[model samples]
Target: MIFDFNKTTDISGWRVVDDGVMGGRSQGSFALNANGNGVFSGTVSLENNGGFSSVRYQTDQMALGSYSKFVLKLKGDGKSYQFRVRSSFRERFSYIGKFETTGKKQTIEIPFATMYPAFRGRTLDLDNYNGETLVEIAFLIGNKKAENFKLEIVSIAVE
Candidate 1:
């Protein structure tokens, strides 16, 4: 188990990052809900050329040589999101995997071999994730338009 959101889970390390960092007007927030789930919800504004919002967690570097995929148990507002990971916090790019969520609760699997390197919104030429070590994980919504989104996460694990 990488992270399991429950009534006693400490979520202070989770942070919201919006397009505001690059002069965009997006806003995002993260918190634990009454049902003991982690909720990432916010508005994605296109003002100032900003249309993305994200929540990220930085964790201790973990060796994942034996893990081939990441599993997420979540419920979304029928939107698409990107699940991202950084092999190292110092790296400028993240390995990203896109997923679409239904309004119902579901489990989504992301294979490390399919996560491609990307910086900002552009994909890089580097190879996919090597599944060596992971230091950061994030969820981002950037459909290039203004909208509101909410994603409730029960847990995240590696398999």
Candidate 2:
């Protein structure tokens, strides 16, 4: 329920995903800061551009089932962003959220049932994330225009 990027002692498991594979475009990468925050920072450009640039982290063992919600600490440059969640790796099912920047260290809460189908445009229960392994965590900025964006992730945890 409480996630603070300034400290990492409470998180039981964590991994960073910065693979450079994109949907026929370019890929985004995630990195950790020397300051010790699990930082997911990258740029989404327009040249040879495909979609977005994001950094992600996933917990190895998920024990936040009934808690069924996640709270994150984020800081960005006042641009549009997406908060994504995935239940399983094999199933490419995920929900995308569109939000603006906070420009400050603020807490963003993502509930399990609020994720909607991107294609069908219907509210789908993200119950699978409950007790289900936290597969992929991503920070992305879509490459719709020739804009440069950075999303710095501080911490991610279930509450």
Candidate 3:
């Protein structure tokens, strides 16, 4: 099943989870655009050790073990962003896949086998993402170049 933004009128569980949780100055916001797309936009500040802003969605655990890839329909500023998925919500780390945007709309496919497990800012040498169930998903931008950024997401699907 796909998470279709166009068909969703209320993005109730989506929330901005920025560096502020760690006393950073970065700020971000998540909202639904008029086109019913998910919009994540905000400024990433370097003040107080802040360097990233993100938005996350928590959903019922989904068994994605059968899927080999994740597809995202999005438009973003010309920059790189991380797509993260977590099997356990209590874990401080997540499996991350980094992709660069082209400043235009596109469908990007990320192979599940390529995503690496990371904690804080360091990549763990543990096994790659092989989670059977996913409880959370997030998008984060932290190029370390501090700038205002925007990303519009239309849909996310597993295949």
Give the winner by lDDT.
Answer: 1
Q: With candidate 2 superimposed using the best TM-score fit, by how many Å does residue 104's alpha carbon deviate from the native?
A: 1.4
Single out the weakest 10-residue window by summed lDDT for candidate 1.
Answer: 88-97
Query: Looking at candidate 1, what is the lDDT of residue 60?
Result: 96
- List ranges where model 2 is wrong by over 4 Å: 1-27, 58-63, 119-133
lDDT of 1: 0.96
Model 2 residue 68 CA deviation (Å) reads 3.1
The whole-model lDDT of each prediction reads 0.96, 0.57, 0.89
Q: What is the TM-score of each predicted model, taking all chains together?
A: 0.99, 0.68, 0.95
What's model 2's TM-score?
0.68
Expressed as tens digits, the lDDT of each residue in 5-116 for candidate 3 is 9745578888898899888888899888889999999999988888999898889888987898889999999989999999887877999999999999989998989999
In the predicted model 2, the residue pairs found to clash are: 1-159
Ordering by TM-score: 1, 3, 2
Ranking the candidates on lDDT from highest down gives 1, 3, 2
Best by TM-score: 1
Better of 2 and 3 by lDDT: 3
Predicted structure 3, TM vs. truth: 0.95
